[model samples]
Target: MTTTSSPLTQDELKAMVGQAALRYIAPGDIVGVGTGSTVNKFIDALATIKDQVRAAVSSSEASTARLQAIGIPVLDANAVEQLSVYVDGADEIDGHGYMIKGGGAALTREKIVAALAQRFVCIADESKRVATLGQFPLPVEVIPMAAQQIARRFAALGGQATLRLKDGQPLVTDNGQHILDVHGLRITDPLAFESAVNQWPGVVTVGVFAHQKASVCLLGTASGVETLTY
Candidate 1:
């Protein structure tokens, strides 16, 4: 007795789990769509059920367009009252619920959207589950005017930082800011790190998403989808 292949690629895996997680999505509930390959699958899945929900807010412009294209009513963030549930994908998740996000460069909006939601649901592959965060470089969204200053600050803190770029020009976020992906910050306390980065001027947002606790995490593995509750 054996099982068939769950999915061939990561995108396929995301769709399988994302559709399963839709069981929790209810009508008339405000939703937030996260940015990432996994979240892309979730968005694609949501397109099928767009008319089933009330309204949606996107963490990235890219996601908003996709949602609109599928007939999912998109709401202005300023007009939004309260988000019922925020469905996002985590770059890394530990047992304590701490996570490192922004691998897709929308950390600022992602955090904002997550905070507006009452519950945050993280969807990812098995590889994203970890005992601790910080094996990867942490992305910090910064104002273009202060990118160099921010880099100097990180250097003083004994961390190497690089400004993400596109075709010789600086990479601009959806919000029109630069991203300084800092390396070698041993984040013993993700909450503290998030605050520390926030303390900096022109620091729009950091990839460290501790405030958004995962009420539930939908993890796709070789066996199948696994739901872990916080």
Candidate 2:
């Protein structure tokens, strides 16, 4: 398939990557969909091949509704025993597959479904790639009652944590909790930081997905889509 010579725009490249993702998905595969612009593009591309595969489980309602609207079947996370593959977008990714997701507030469910998949394929533009995992702020969800305390706790860990808000209100997750975006973490041990945050009282979930690593990362670039395997 020939693409534009002048480098497809970011949105155009994302769409290309989304279409490319379909090739790896076989018929009768139960896939997990992650959140973000790239995944949205993937859903649009998947619509063309909805009948080519089995139903997909989405981590966010936004994606679920989009899939259904495009004639692709949608299933709940618990509805499937094992996912053949998961193609989702990531906020930031490291060489080792350590990532900071949940910019879409679906990180918790995304990670849950990803854990059950044999392979998690992270789709993103070249810009999403980072040398380290924490250059981007990490999103952590907490109960409304404890969001402040959790933010303080995250700050104490040498990171800046702010309760994510929208239009003067705290941003709430699909699980009905507030989100704290932690910035400036030099995370060498993502698992350790994940554990430390989870141990905090009233912490609902953190965006660190160290427990589930990406089997492959599809980076859409001005040049083209480059595949990275961990």
Candidate 3:
């Protein structure tokens, strides 16, 4: 009789990659944590070895609460000069490690934390890998006053921008800003696109993580975990 194994669910894949990411952590090193469900998995995994690391610098309040709940010490970003590694999840990661993040509306903070890290390790399921970015709506954090103007800017770029709402009101970021989710953009050159959008007034963050691209990616697959290095 022949038997087959059950397929790995998305959560299982996430957990696998999350656990895989632990190898990158060293004792006495401060880990930089990002926001999102996938990163939540990494946080849970990190808690298992909480004593191995000194502390964590979180990119969002939600992640900070989760880290504290799991008994991992959370540090203020300003208090940390640098991090050993930033392990975060990407919404869409391309071949060159360029990513489109901010699905959780934590782009600005995430970018800040990523900037302070020596290396970035992206953890994600295989579904997140793409040939090119733009399938997933790009998130842009902007000041409230410039929200409409930024929307027009994206529209000029052949994309449709919509204000992200929560509970019938505009969602406010941790920075007290608004987010515009731009659709219909095929970002071929992420570095250039990110640089250009950032030059526009009212744009706090463009959600294109080119400057802080991942050095390594732990991609979860149905078979197991695949590690890719840029």
Candidate 4:
């Protein structure tokens, strides 16, 4: 495989990591899929192995549709007992494997599918790697009625919370929840913040993946695919 040299384009890196993720899929195993641009490339890669894997449990409707379009069966997460791997991308990832995800507004389902998988393989371009989490705004899925209250709570925590909007309207998740992207947080304690935010009323899921952190990260760099474990 020819890797892009120094000054690699984002697409090139995504494709590299996306193709590398196929190595984690075993014959007849149910794969867990997540949403986003990088994962879109992974879905494309997965199409080549459609017949080898049994089925896939997607974290969002977008991924499910893509998997089905590529001749890969999309199954309900409830029907699947075990998943060999969960492949997803992150907004920001630290060396410890903790990540800030949900930029696609699929945080709730992504977290659920991630929890069900045996291995969480985060595929991303090198730009996402960070020394600490929270450079990218952390996404928090919350009930519609609680949006303002949650925003206020995040403000109290020194975060600037903004309701995610799409096409001039509030963006709604597959679970019919709204997303609050919180900024200005340099999360030095991911586990503690994740737990604190999770206990807040009306919070569906926090973007922090501290509890279900990645088992491995396939980071695409100018040199090659750099593998990191936590």
Candidate 5:
């Protein structure tokens, strides 16, 4: 008889890292939660310890609903002066801890929540780890009227900027903005690039998280979870 063991799926790896992130949460502290599939798993894990944390400030409306559904109180980021930690997943993460996020169109709020946290703990499957940033299209939230203008600006920088759409219509973010996904970028100096793009008129937030890079990254691999410190 031949027997085979199935390999662990990416979602399973995500769940592992998501559960590992729970240790970073301290009792009685308000946590900042980011948006994404991996974060969804984190929310499920958080539910198991919902009574320990005071509340959570969610980066997206979806996350707010999920947290509420699981009996976790969701607070406004403005009301919270500081969070013990911010847990989020990345589209791509480099060795230096810089990441390209916003694949879920929640970059703006995610950045806000990240800025308010003492520690930013990134949780992701090992596939997200990269030696360089930018394999995934970089998401840039822009003012609707400035979409074309911003695309031109990105084009000048040698990036192919495309407007994100949903259901055959332009996708609108929770903040009522448009997203420009810029392809063909391999960011070497994330901090500088983020600053430059941010200065562009009508640009809301660039996907690069160099300024508020992760303090620690929990990478789930087939072997186990790997802890990487920035």
Candidate 6:
């Protein structure tokens, strides 16, 4: 990866990487699109090439609307057997490409879409890269009845889990489940932690993307976009 001399603003960097992601697309391919602001930039860029790809499989309803609004077709994930690439942003991505996502409360769907893709291409500003995971709170979608029980499980693991709130009430996910954002964790073994948490009864999906880790990352820097291949 190389850097440019002149520095660019954060939004400029995001747009730069967003536009750069277009190179990964192949004509007539079905793309797996993710959610978030950085990804929103990618979605806008995708509109310019809407006719190139057959259709998009979005991770959230919001993204589906955006794609349809731009005249790009959106397909149900069940209809697509596999995708050429899944482009999404990470809340925190480590050296190994493992990430903590779901900051947008779309973790469950994001993971589902990611599972249907052959490649996971993570797009992010440089700030999202980290030496280790877990500085950002880990989001876990849980069955409502087990919210408190799940929180206690995190406490036993030395982390604090709190129900995510919006409008002074529990924020419900698209799956009609509640989210528990766990804090105070330093995830050295993301795969193991993810496996363990997922085994808990109430857990629908854990924010850790170890199994569906990124194959490549387009990191936006002050200078330009840096490509990292894992």
Q: Pick the candidate with the highest TM-score.
A: 3
Ranking by TM-score: 3, 5, 4, 6, 2, 1
112-190 in candidate 3: lDDT tens per residue? 9999999999999999999999999999999999999889988999999999999999999999999999999999999
Give the alpha carbon lDDT tens digit for every residue of 59-95 in model 1.
9988888888888877878888778888988888887
Candidate 5 per-residue C-alpha lDDT over 1-230 given as tens digits, one digit per residue, 9 for 90 to 100: 99987877999999999999999998998999999999999999999999998999999999999999998889988798988899999999999999999999999999999999999999999999999998899999999999999999888878999999999899999999999999998899999999999998999999999999999999999888999999
Task: Identify the runs in model 6 with alpha carbons over 4 angstroms from their true place.
Answer: 1-7
- Predictions in order: lDDT: 0.84, 0.85, 0.96, 0.94, 0.95, 0.93
Model 4 residue runs over 4 Å out of place are 1-6
Q: Can you list the residue pairs that collide in candidate 4?
A: none
Which pairs of residues collide in candidate 6?
none
Give the per-residue lDDT of model 2 (tens digit) for 53-107. 6888989889989988987788877778898899998888888887889899888
Total clashing pairs for each candidate: 0, 0, 0, 0, 0, 0
lDDT of 4 at 43: 94
Give me the runs in candidate 5 sitting further than 4 Å from their true place: 1-4
Ranking by lDDT: 3, 5, 4, 6, 2, 1
Model 2, CA-based lDDT: 0.85
Which candidate, 2 or 3, has the higher lDDT?
A: 3
The RMSD of every model to the true structure, in order and in angstroms, is 2.0, 2.7, 0.7, 2.5, 1.1, 3.0
Q: Which of the two, 2 or 6, has more lDDT?
A: 6
Steric clash count of candidate 3: 0
TM-score of each: 0.92, 0.94, 0.99, 0.96, 0.98, 0.96
Model 2 off-target regions past 4 Å?
A: 1-5
Question: Least accurate stretch of 10 residues (summed lDDT) in model 6?
Answer: 4-13
> Any idea how many clashes model 2 has?
0
Q: What is the lDDT of candidate 3?
A: 0.96
